[model samples]
Target: MASEELEYAGFWIRVWASVIDTLLLGIVVYPLLTAIYGDAYWEGANFVHGPLDFLISWVLPAVAVVAFWMARQATPGKMAIAARIVDANTGNNPSTGQLLIRYLGYFVSCIPLGLGIFWVAFDSRKQGWHDKMAGTVVVRKKSGTTRPVEFNA
Candidate 1:
């Protein structure tokens, strides 16, 4: 059991985490993309411009996110807010397979007018569809304390 009190991170905090992550990623990725493909990259008709775009626009973020999850159990944004991802049932770190599924599940959560993501607001466990799909949850110690979340409790 967790030695201290924990809270399910609510919608607003998660949104802020996502915002921070997106902005940070954009800061790094957009310039590189423009440098590699030129400003026309934005107005290009193709979803991806070329090989460099595929590597930059697609592969880089995937690798970075999974790497972060493996190393920290959270992205920089989640880390900023002292949140972590864990197995929904175990309250322990999720396996690599689960983390990958969780990443892919973001597409599913965002597909249906983002109803899946918004589901977090109503779910008793405070899970988005991605979380439910991957059997994972985002959790944190409430306030400034370090009461790590323990799911088995």
Candidate 2:
């Protein structure tokens, strides 16, 4: 088996990818919610209720679980960026239980005002707190071919 090493994704690329993913998710979800609840959903006293926060607290974790699980298992976003997530211990895709644990760890990372995301920017291994907790790493996918280089003398 090939050795799977963790690839440090540059901070900017990761930020951009996350922005794209969030926008895509919002584009799909917002319209679906609007359609289901109708324009009146945002009217009246109920509009100012705490349901949005309630929904978020519950839904966001679930979404993160599904997204990370799929990404780790199938390399979804990582595949798009020529990367992969693998278990640090085994150098293979993480198990479902590991993925769930990883997702749960996100809450911890977010506790101190999202220091986990910052950890990626400065950590020696570029592993976020969640990554460390889950024992997983993201690595660039290996390209089979090398490019020719020309040098000026």
* The candidate that achieves the highest lDDT relative to the unseen native structure: 1
* Candidate 1: residue 45 lDDT (0-100): 93
Tens-place lDDT per residue, model 1, 1-153, is 372567788787899999999999999899999998888888889987889889988899999999999999999999999888889887888999999999999999999999999998887767999899899989887764333445654
Error in Å for residue 20 of model 2: 2.1
Model 1, residue 93: what's the lDDT?
Answer: 85
Off by over 4 Å in 2: 4-6, 39-68, 71-76, 142-153
Backbone clashes in candidate 2 total 1
Candidate 2 RMSD to the correct structure = 7.8
Report the C-alpha lDDT of model 2 over 1-153, residue by residue, as the tens digit: 354322455455556666665666567556655766666655745533356534643676377546766665533444467655667666667877767777788789889999986787886555688888988765554433322111121
Angstrom error of the Cα, residue 113, model 1: value is: 0.9
True lDDT of residue 53, candidate 2:
39
Model 2: pairs clashing at backbone N, Cα or C within 3 Å: 7-139
